[model samples]
Target: MGILSINMDDPMDVDALDAFLKIAEYRSLSAVAKLYGVPKSTLSLRLKQLEGELNTSLFLREGRSLVLTEAGQTLRTHAADILGRCEAARMAVAETLDDASGMLRIGATGEFGTAFYSQMLFAFRRRYPKVQLDLSFFSPHTLYLPERQEMMDAIISWDDGNAGQGGAEQLWTDRFCLYASRDYLARMGTPATPAELEEHQAVMFRQPAGPQLWLLQRDAETLSILPRSDLFANEYWTVKYFAVASEGIAYLPSFFTQIECERGDLVRVLPGWESAQQRVTLRVMRPSALSRRMGAFIDFCRDYFSPGYVFNGPRYYVETIFNPTNTTQTGEQR
Candidate 1:
């Protein structure tokens, strides 16, 4: 409970610090030792030395594994951080080094945001475990320009109003589809085309009635439809839930309904109707002014989502030009 004398005079204890952190993470001395290709005895001795220096017992044995004591858990936190700094310093020695650790603030829409973010975020975390991620989700709105927020390092959005404002990158393109519960289709009958959509009971988005026409392509000709709905809700999740419950037909992104469609829970009506592209883009709001850590994250995304990096249905598109006017970025990074 008393303040302990902290010693900074000691030369950087990188090895011991790394060992302790690893041990704490694995909760096993043998595991840490094996990981570092060192004997368990040496690992145990190094940990003990660290404890002695700090004048505290860092861990307690419980069965075959080690559990951090109250003091130990606190030490583990610091040790991991210290090790991270050491790695960064080592990288700094080389001109090619990039800082890969820091807090990255991101914003996105609810449905599509939740669907892709969970996986994209998970993968990013695994690759850059040291980076702290903060995400905010909202319905599509021209609220805060990603650059103005300053806090938001990047934005993955369908709206490209701020596309070229800062260094921007496009992640993926999203397609909206008319979806309904299987049971509802069996009873209400499936509409063969957009014109037929009027007859089905529908769930609409936000304070609006009737089905919203999703423009598929607008170059040579404009493809649009007016969806009729009895129930209206602001959130995409709400529409999805209602659709799943056999309430009515809801227009939603294919990605969000992909799982359900595959499982036969939801069916895509009016196949071959190309939904106008909803530009799914990522804009680096503060690219040039990015901190070293933020830069690393941007680089990670560029590579992680690159076509060659991983193969999947969702393609990545990179728009060279950043358009601050339009709602979506034209570049595809997929």
Candidate 2:
């Protein structure tokens, strides 16, 4: 193949360039002409003008079939790129004239999305009534699965290690904490130290792959908890329920246990301990260029989850859990 130079004295026509690219794509001038609502003769004439400007034979005809020459193939590459930029600019301008309207699909674990993020979703919809919001809550382990990954426009969940390979941005940081209902604590006699956790019956969250290990730290000190237990559940709410039923000690996200803790329904096992902080990031693995609606949604999420965003849950207190008078004198489990 030989290099062909365009004459700077004469620039190519944008419409002609678009037609040339379309002809290259369809491989038939008549087909492209009909698609564009133009005559076949006009398509050929424009392409000839483009070829004339470049001073090369654009195509060779064999009977009714047209084949592109080496130079024509080169021009086709440049023409497609030039045409794409024009289309993109047109779309960008058109967005400013119209409201952002489209469907946005987000993915996250049922535990986090339903408990915390649902509020954010409702707020987002209030701002963009024209844009439909679809929040899909899936199992935690399935987040990185190829099919599920393809469905989310944006995802809000714990930083999945695999997601870093794609477009993952850390939105917030949170830590898990050991929590057990007052009833359970009363029955187990409260594990004052991390070492005492070994003797206490523990309720644990089992992921799809296996049980998650419990690691806690405080400054230079650290502890690895291997609690003895029989109770297990996948859902965080279920784990909380089991703990409330005096089943065992459960470790849950701090945000989820905040209400329970404040009301004294659940007590922190080790006040000195802090679980390793897990980062939560907004991940976008689906489309290459986000639509206007999706971009607006992402921006809304960043601010909504910001630390400065004031949020407080309604104060709730249970008489049986918080007041000794409401319970039996023994305060002992059945």
| Top TM-score prediction, candidate number | 2
The C-alpha lDDT values of all candidates are 0.66, 0.73
lDDT, candidate 2, 1-334, per-residue tens = 4457799979899988878766765679988877667999999899888888888877777777677889988887777668667656754664675676756778886766556777677777777888877677776577768756654677777756654667688777888888887766776688888888888998888777766678899999887766787887777767777766567888887887776677666788787787887877788754478678777877877887887886443332222333343353333221
lDDT of 1: 0.66
Candidate 2 C-alpha RMSD relative to the actual structure: 14.2
What ranges in model 1 sit over 4 Å off? 1-99, 138-143, 146-148, 207-212, 217-221, 307-334
**What ranges in model 2 sit over 4 Å off?**
1-98, 286-288, 311-334
Residue range 1-334, candidate 1, lDDT tens digits: 3222346775436788878877876799877666557899988888877776777787888999888888877776677667656654644553244546656678775555545676787777877787788786654554254322543567776654655455556766667877886668888888886677778887887633434556655346657666666787776777787777677888788877776677566787776665766666777665555566667677776776766875243422111233333233321111
Query: Scored by Cα lDDT, where does model 2 land?
Result: 0.73
lDDT of 2 at 183: 66
